[model samples]
Target: MSAGSPVNLVVLVEERSADEALRALLPKITPGVAFRIAPFDGKEDLLRKLPHRFREYTYYWRAVNSRVVVLVDRDDDDCLELKAQLSRMAKEAGLPAEAVLFRIVIEELEAWFLGDVPAVHAAYPRVSLDLVKRVKFREPEDVPGGAWEALEHLFQQHGYHKKGLAKMIAARDIAPHMDVENNRSQSFQVFRDGLRRLVSEEN
Candidate 1:
């Protein structure tokens, strides 16, 4: 938050874990900026409601001095096509492109945890960064198979969370430990940049 640039941010997240992660991460990123999380049941729900939501937000935010960031997982879709689709949705919603920002966490939110190996270590404490370092995808965010599943498998092999991953717990444990400056995921870079741009101006 820059001096005199008051911002109210509405984060439209795809999952509960995303909501939990952003709830912890955003305030650390933008101190003094007012923001709230609007979590969807999942990716499908977010896409289904996005057009209407954008239209409603356009009208409502005008009175509240606010802006919105729509966050989703790319999830096997063509990233360029997905972004263009969202742009079209916003335009059809009667909202200007400048009024809202869209960001995709490629694969899924957990890939972000893999991006910052130290954060993952800090969260789980037993997983070795060396194991994460040896994965085929150099950038974990670009992993083809579900990133969350990969993370679960890793932990499961190591005798942690044998039942299953609790997404909320994983998010809460890892997000606060993420080092913003050290993450290698391009998607994380885009998200960070988008947030900065969104809050750079006075609402």
Candidate 2:
């Protein structure tokens, strides 16, 4: 979506955690570029409603001067297939390929927290930086079994409450401190690059 007004970025995410994380990350990367989040109830709900959302966006594409970015978790699905499905939905909605972008976090959003260990340590100082520095995390977008569990495990090792893995607080805390340019997660890099491309084109 692109109207004659300044560029507006509409990002659709899986839930509150993603929205919280983006709130922390977007300003640093796209200052002066307006952005908003449309978060659904978890991944399943997002996937179920996404095609309809894309169709809805087509109606305002020109009027709003907005661009749609769809972000999802790669939870158990084939990444390429999921992307292709989203692309198909966009085309079906009569949106030009360039009008919308789709990105998936491999295992889960927690992987992004792992991408910048320092940010994680900063968010929850109780979690020792030394431990974070020593333990290796899998790729951000595609963890094998349980990304949140892995994160919780790491926290446990470092002395955070056994059951108090606060997702939103952690995202809010870590995002502000993350080095968007040097994140260790490939998926995170791709996400940032996509936003940069959109912002550059708008400029």
Candidate 3:
């Protein structure tokens, strides 16, 4: 696609927490990408809200005109049905299955902060079961406090070694911290800046 074209992203999340986090992270990770964050209160909401017509709109209008479409969803069992439905919708829309991406973050927004469980524990020697569980099963109300603090601790405690699986975890964990409404607009800006720096040094 041409540089002038916008990168269209269709993100589906089970709760407000995941929605807000995806909203915060996408633009930062992929600059100039235009996104729509659709929040489903639950499995029923997703099935009812995302009709075949919307799928057509996504495929024909947005997909055709944009550079890419990144679809993010949670990995709960309830979401399995939705995933299959989306896949079929994508095919009907004439888009390649690969063109419709999935970032199934296990156990919702907390997964962003904790990364993979074993990796997180390895990084933080003092982590307790409560802290671990909280990070793994975080709700919307669970955010805006210790969540960000824990993530910051992860980065600091790990010495900011941004590479390999560790870097992936760091990026995923730090991404959700930017979802505070006041900070949303600047999320993409900060992420893009950091990504650029990382890429430059890597090369």
Candidate 4:
């Protein structure tokens, strides 16, 4: 691809919130490798359509330079089992392994925001800078009582999203200020590294 040409990276996400978060984050990591995020109504919807999507992508794969990433929240499911299912679907669709990357968020997208307290603080000035020093939040993926609930409580304490967490809004506010290199969430780090590796392999 030329300096100005679009990068052929495609990211398939479970919800608008994931899309919103990645919109701000991908650019930071990918730099000149422009990407596209395709969000489904929800995880179930994405899984329902993934097989067909993979099949259709055969055209894109043959006709253009491209890669697809399927990202989902692990929720209450077994992470390894979920990954195996996704891999099976992609393989059944006959997609080359290099053409797709499947990633499962440990609990949810909010964990990524919690990964970098500085980013959250930068976006919400009321959020305490000392938050990361606390035991509960020091580990983003393992945030006590779950990531989404922890973030909701934190945001509420900071006087934002008092009426429950508005995911897309939170993503919009927090993601732009996130530092890719400084995130402490192991899952987020894996995602960042995997995406960079995928993009680099194309060159």
Candidate 5:
């Protein structure tokens, strides 16, 4: 682990979108830790396939540097269950829990990008206004007509709701949009730089 050497990271995600979002945002969020996105087919794939994949990559990562990170999204109500399973797997593999990081956004991945009820409706128009309001906690008047239609059209064009499409869209397209909207460039840099300074001081 020499200074200036890239920190190797292993991302355990199912789709290209998650890969892209993590690749774009993680380095900005944690400087000095360069990462690469490695995809697994899906949750079922993880169950059936991850042990082999993890074994293969774990050896590779240890050879380079004993640093790695795993990220996954909890897609539905089974999120907590998934985390427990992953935790058990990590322990069995002799990896500390901190070596893996998990994030379960409270809502669909799309919510991470749009943030507000109206913005989500604008991005996804086909959903019923009532449903959108229920999810986003905003009044119907807050959403303009035609916004939902446009969003629905966008989702359809992108083939959303199809198998594995939502994750792809979130990582590749929507996350970047949210990053920019949230001024993530500045925020991430600040957090990274501050963390580095703190680490150096403690050392």
Candidate 6:
């Protein structure tokens, strides 16, 4: 949704790729709710600005009936501690906990795409459908090196994104084919659940 359009939710993501992915995913899960995405340059940028943004969102809530969702990547950090920090930032900004949902993508947004292998295959027909059956790919969030690295490898092996994984293009192409109910990443499921809960509460 456009910034001026009535929005039920405003998602704060760390990059354009995530914003692109959710642009496709949110409509499937959040029926009847209009939403907007605000993408920062990177994780550090988002973390640095969240307090001020949260404070603005507190005002936005009353003015536009919009709630907020803050999505970040866990990377190598401890998940629980990171989540607590986000909650603390919101609290400090005087943004009510109930008015915001903070979700961490266990490694990165690429992990969500890895969680739904069939969606990848749908977007890039050259990718192997048997990827889900592989032992290493069984748990997407647990992949060793890093989620994006793994995705880059896969795309290269399939002759797609040969030079590098074009994150925005990948997200835009794959997200539309994702099966929200079938995604295997626990983090993705948590994200979906939290978003649904937020929508349900308001609706």
TM-scores for every predicted model: 0.90, 0.89, 0.47, 0.94, 0.57, 0.93
Clashes of each: 0, 8, 1, 0, 7, 0
Which 10-residue span in candidate 3 carries the lowest summed lDDT?
A: 179-188
Per-residue lDDT over 44-105 for candidate 3, one digit per residue giving the tens place of the 0 to 100 score = 66646555535655556543443223233444454566567766766665655433443333
For the record, the alpha-carbon RMSD of candidate 1 to the native fold, in angstroms, is 2.6
Q: List the residue pairs that clash in candidate 3.
A: 112-173
Winner by TM-score: 4
TM-score ranking of the models: 4, 6, 1, 2, 5, 3
Candidate 5 lDDT, 41-126, residue by residue in tens = 76567566666665665555545543444445455547678768766766676665434454443333333433333333444555
> Could you tell which candidate, 3 or 5, scores higher by TM-score?
5
Q: Report every candidate's CA lDDT.
A: 0.83, 0.80, 0.46, 0.89, 0.48, 0.89
Kindly list the per-residue Cα lDDT of model 6 for residues 93-182, writing each as its tens digit.
888877789898987888899999999999999888999998878899888788899999999998999999999999999999999999
Residues 32-59 of candidate 1: C-alpha lDDT, one tens digit per residue: 8899899999889999999889889878
TM-score of 1: 0.90
In candidate 6, how many Å is residue 15 off? Answer: 0.5
Candidate 2 residue 8 C-alpha distance from true site, Å: 0.3
User: Which pairs clash in model 2?
Assistant: 1-66, 2-65, 3-65, 106-141, 106-142, 107-141, 107-142, 107-143
Regions of model 1 farther than 4 Å from truth: 1-5, 135-137
